[model samples]
Target: MSHYWDNLSARTNGQHTSEEFESAAYRLVVEQVIYYADRHSRATYWLIEGFERDFREALAPLGITLDVNRQLRYVYAKPQYAKAGTASVAQTLLALVLRALYDEGARLGQFTDDGEVVCDLVELEEKYRLMTGRELPGKGEFSELMRTMKRWGIAKKSDESLVQRGDSDQTLPYAVIIRPAIADILGEMALLRLAQWKELDHMPRIEDTESEDDHEVTE
Candidate 1:
């Protein structure tokens, strides 16, 4: 066995093997999070609990925090300060909107067995308009936004495997399943920033924050 394995065994008291640790770590790292309710990720989610200490230790040096929610049955890595210079302002807005939707669903007890909140395109459009005073993005941008949501573990389409199905290259994926990870990803801080969005003279740059949008938008 490798050095990490040997040490991990001793540290975890042999409750979980090195391979289990590796699997759990890989999923947490690759997916940015893991939830027990997600059928494909259920096993790894429990494994993460066993190796939580090691995960925190490994992530601490990089200024990332590993949070495990026992009630929610999920684990995710959160950076102290992150500059995600990839997703656009519109995309970020959509993500925040989805997070708000999840909150609403939670309050209303509208959740799936896996704790996901479901909504369709029309409802999303209405919420977007009500929240941001804007309609959904253009078709091309909508497609990209959906891709961003899934890539960042925010939301997923019902037909997730085929997000853009029609010949128009537009995602009419009316039905979407908002992941529970959004709560951790956006948190209350990010949502507060989003609620104050209209007051800002400048828009959120592609380089916004992770747990919070610390990058102050300026003209």
Candidate 2:
């Protein structure tokens, strides 16, 4: 056996010979929603590309499926045994809002050739208000939510400190990069759930919503 296989075998106590690659693949998928060939570091992309088959085979045993979007140049994982409350109420709502904006942008042909939907905090807030018939969360809360979204690889902000200002001024536009990963995170079922939530007699108060920091992911 090769040195890599030998190390892997030793690590798995002879139960598996490819555990090393599998473990690495599992970590990469869980850490980020998408691994973009164009945006990710060369080494990171190469690692995923090189072990794509092993990655899928390993994850299959754990009920996690790997999805590689070649055209979009990214890879995402779908867990068969999905756990509830992986995202906070605020984060979930924000994702729905972003998904709504993305769909609207696509319908209006506003997306760039590369498939990115660029929007600002102001537009997002306006769309939220229109959709939910409620004011968007305060600057502090919205900023924190944006940080969580960015951490999860669903969105990116042009100005790191823009959200920290805590000003509700809609005129001050801060550019946000709405990544395609949003679609994967908030799939069809999630959207349906959001729609049902919106139809509730009383929507949950934004201030009372829990932060993403309080969430836990489990299989």
Candidate 3:
């Protein structure tokens, strides 16, 4: 991916005025940060497919490792943090999707015939657009961002043979995994927003947080 970065920058004019670039960069940052936060994680082949190999190599200084096989791709750390960082939108979306998966009790592995798996990038972004009433970063940016997540173990890809309808060339369709650590991070984010929401006049306040109560607080 490092080799392509120059071309990407040249074509996009350094992505100075591009929301797509900004979003993609944000995703990359999130993926990197989350990967460091979790010492060990792995990815499937589908998860890392769209990501650039050079990009993964750049992350090697940080103790990130990539393992690839015919049926799967894996990435993780060795109980330490890497000091490198880069800025990609694919990474951010990867984190967001993984957080959602953690909340929903799914792993960042392959989607199976008997089980639900990570959400597809297209469908996931479409949902985000619908919720926010705006278009998301382009597909290229999204792919890059997911590649970052796949590298960090925050998310993984699903095997395609389980769900694909036709005899497609692809073996696995990518999906995000929301790791336990990632879920905690996401929960913290949600908690921050919840705190912010409570500050709003329109939001319902919790009376229990204000004073002593006879019983434990309940939602």
CA lDDT of each prediction against the hidden true structure: 0.75, 0.66, 0.42
Candidate 3, residues 38-149, lDDT tens digits: the string is 2232222222333446436544664654433323232222313543344332243335544554454453444433232456555566655543333566767656665655
The best candidate by TM-score is: 1
Query: Model 2 — TM-score against the truth?
Result: 0.71
Model 2 misplaced regions, further than 4 Å: 1-26, 37-40, 159-173, 201-219
- Per-prediction TM-score: 0.73, 0.71, 0.36
Count steric clashes of candidate 1: 0
lDDT of 1 by residue, 1-219 (tens): 256756886776777777777667666767887878778888788777766887787667677788888876788877777765445568767888898999999999998877789987768888988887667898788878888788788787786532444566655546878988898777687678666766552565334534544344211
Question: Could you say which candidate leads in lDDT?
Answer: 1
- How would you encode candidate 2's per-residue C-alpha lDDT over 113-198 as one tens digit per residue? 55778887667778787775667789888889889878777776764424423455334547777877778877666556556545
Q: After superposition, how far is residue 179 of candidate 3 from its true place, in Å?
A: 4.0
> What does candidate 1 score on TM?
0.73
Name model 3 segments beyond 4 Å from true.
1-94, 105-117, 130-132, 159-173, 190-219
